[model samples]
Target: MFAIFKIFFGLGWVSFGGPAAHIGYFRNTFVEKLGWLRDEEYAQIVALSQFLPGPGSSQVGFAVGYQRAGLGGGIMAFLGFTLPSVILMLLLAVLSSQLTESSYFQNVVHGLKLLAVLVVADAAWGMYRNFCKSPLTVTLCIGTAIALLLFQSVASQVLVLVIAAAVGVRYLAHGNVTKDKPASATRSFSWLPLASFFVLLLTLPLVGTYSSSVQLFSDFYQAGSLVFGGGHVVLPLLQNIVGDQLTQDAFLTGYAAAQAVPGPMFTFATYIGYELMPSAPLLGAIIATLGVFVPGFLLLVGVLKNWQQLAAIPAVSGALVGVNAAVVGLLLSALYQPVFTSAVITPLDLCWVLLGALLMKQFKLPIVWMVICFAAAGFMAPSVANLI
Candidate 1:
């Protein structure tokens, strides 16, 4: 358990690019490379994580943790994956009051925006490899990708995903269900865990009034439970929750600061917690961190018990395959909205985007360095202001 915590705790610190990148990172490090799990099992977890309510990356972190240790392992993994960014974000929130003037901070933020685009692109590529294996999948991936790029909303893309899956299931798969073993439901729950989770979830909104600690906890916990897309999508929502009700300038500044950092955006929530109420920053910070991350853990465990049921349905399985393909499309849409839209403000910027893409796919450059170079260049360029 300790080892699990240490390793995953370390992962939390470094894992970047939101949930899709995190998923790719897990697949590469744990599945394809470490041989810790079979591909099919990993896909099962990926599919299972999607059905949960929070960020997909958060759920993946929980499942990876569970796979390594069980309940304890899962908890450690989430802590590990989340702790780094949370600490960094909290520190950033503290620092934002002063750090806005730092050139280093600005440059880093500039680089990060570029890096985030690259990271998301890499994530899309990985998803494509997994989901674009069949013609039906390709159609869903491409069609949804186009639709999302046009409409440009996560909710819209989810609608497209559901509709596409339904059509694909009824027509493409001929309404056939996948045949499998007669699966029985998991008898894994204790009433205590379920009851406690519901009770906490129901009352989370009422928490922050007691103290800043309560406020921080409630804010993050609520976000952890409610966010549905992935880590990136959580950004604007988190900003609204922490920033709007707190200090607008400080929250926005911290968000900018988080962009400059090298880890997960979820960590940014920690920064919001610490900065918003610093009279007792430690308690607020700790509580806020736990509150946001705990939902991710619960979401994973809750979904895992039902994963076998999804695996059992052939029609549902086919629909899932379509949905998984749509996930790739959804990612592509995300790339366009922020990545391409922000980065391609000029011809020079387009060159950089193409260069960065080539470096990633053709030369296989390290994402950290690729992001850094382009971001620096972009920040230095005369057109940088136009892009930002």
Candidate 2:
């Protein structure tokens, strides 16, 4: 457990890039370096995470720890991996009032927003390559992306995924059956976590009316529960939930900060929680963070041990393929909207993004170096414009 915590805690400090990058990092560390799990096991955990609604990479990390130690290990893994961003986000919330008006700070935020564009684009492309190999999957990916681009809402997101799953079952299930035996009997599996998941989902709203704090938790919990694609997809849901309470600028700033940080982007909740409750900021932060993370963890725990059995089913495996393709589309839509539209304002900005992509693809610079380069460019952008 301690080892799990230590490894993830270290990762929390250096895991730049988004969920896709984090997944790569986990593969390298746990699979390649540490030998904690085999390549196939890691892939299984990742597939399970994608199939479930949650923070994709973080769920993978949690399942890794769970595989190593158990539930306690999973908790430690989440805390270790999440702590740095939680601290950074809370601090950003505390400092944002002083920094928001500073021109230099605004420039840095802009840089990070652009960074978000590059990260999301990279993730979308990578997923597309991995999941959209077949004609049906390519069609699902394109269709889902077009649909979301047209109708941007949580309901639409859910609808596309459901439709994609049905399509996959109809068209893709025939030859996908696996012969692996079930890992454990159903009677031996624990259902407590699933029960708890439903109980909270049903009861949180009932209790939310009694306290603003509870309402905040409920809103974030819903966001975490419903976010299917990745952390990037959480933006619209959060914006709709808290937009009236916080200014668009504040919300966007927090998002950019999440991108700038080096851990799970879901820690954006920590910032939101602090902003929502100025009086007892820490309490709000803790509650909101826990709320957003709990449902995902619960669902993961409920399904982790039994995932092999489910994956062995031809229909389920087929559905996963469609789900994965749809996720790529969801991410592609996200890249264009809030990420690209919000960040790329000028032709110069587009050029910078292209250059960054080149550096990442051809030069193969580390993400930290990319962050430094983009930030420096942002800081100098105004001065360079003046000279021009």
Candidate 3:
């Protein structure tokens, strides 16, 4: 447990970029470096998280930790993984007024955005090789990407996954997936966890009508529960939920801050909650964070024992393949818009991404070092801009 906590805590500090990058970091550390899980094992966790709503990357981390050290380890992993981003976001919320005016800081954020492009590109490539092996899977990847690029929203994203699953069941049903099953799932388990998951989903809305805090929890929780293709997909839902509470500038600032931090992108809630309830920032942060995260964990717990069994079922396996392929497409579409379009603003910016990608692929520079270099570049970009 200590080992799990320590590693995740370290990752929390440096796991910048976004969900795709975070997945890459986890794959590198746990699968390649530590041998905590095999490639296929890690892929299964990722695929499961991709299918579920909530913070997909964080759920993957939780699943990985659960596999390592029981339910306790899962909780510890969530804490260690989220602690840094939560703290950083809260601090940013408090100092948002000052930080927004700082040009150097803005440049640093710009650099990080560039880093996001490189990191996500690397992740997409790696995931493609690992998950999109068959021609049908590759076609699903492309088709999902085009569909999402055409209709970009939480609703469309979910639709794509559903369609993909249906296609998978129809097409890939007979294909084999090989992996050793975990020992824990072999034991008897209860239906209570699954029951509790739906109960909360149903009850939260009713309770929310009476209390503002409950409303906040419900809004974020609902966003977490329903937003597919996590990270970017959650943004519009949150924008609508807190539209009246925060000014557009303040909300945009928090969104920018979220991009700069590590851990789960869902920690954007920490900043919003702190801003909304300044008198009780800590409490607000905690409530919002847990509200957004708890549903995913609950769902994971409910499904834990059934995962292997479900995997063995031919129809389920086919749907999983479809879901996995669609995930790659979702990532591809995301790479173009908010990531690529937002990051690469000029020829120079494109050059920076190319350079960073080389350093990442050829030199295999540590993410921390890449962060430092890009931050320096960001700090200097303003000066370079003036000269240009």
Maximum-lDDT candidate: 3
Residue-wise C-alpha lDDT for candidate 3, range 108-159, written one tens digit per residue: 8788779888877766776788779999999999999999899977688778
* Highest-TM-score candidate: 3
TM-score of each: 0.80, 0.76, 0.87
Question: Local error of candidate 1 at 95, Å?
Answer: 2.0
| Regions of candidate 1 where Cα sits further than 4 Å from its true position | 1-14, 37-44, 171-183, 186-194, 204-216, 231-245, 344-388
> Per-residue error at 121 for model 2, in Å?
2.8
lDDT of 1 by residue, 261-287 (tens): 544566666676665566777666677
226-315: candidate 2 lDDT, tens digit per residue: 887677888888898886899988998888788777788889899999888989999989988998888899999998877756755777
- Computed on alpha carbons, the lDDT of every model, listed in order, comes to 0.66, 0.81, 0.82
Worst 10 residues of 3 by lDDT: 177-186
Model 1 clash count equals 10
Quality of model 2 by C-alpha lDDT:
0.81
- In terms of TM-score, how similar is model 1 to the real structure? 0.80
Candidate 2, clashing residue pairs?
Answer: none
* C-alpha positional error of residue 357 in candidate 1 after TM-score superposition, expressed in Å: 5.0
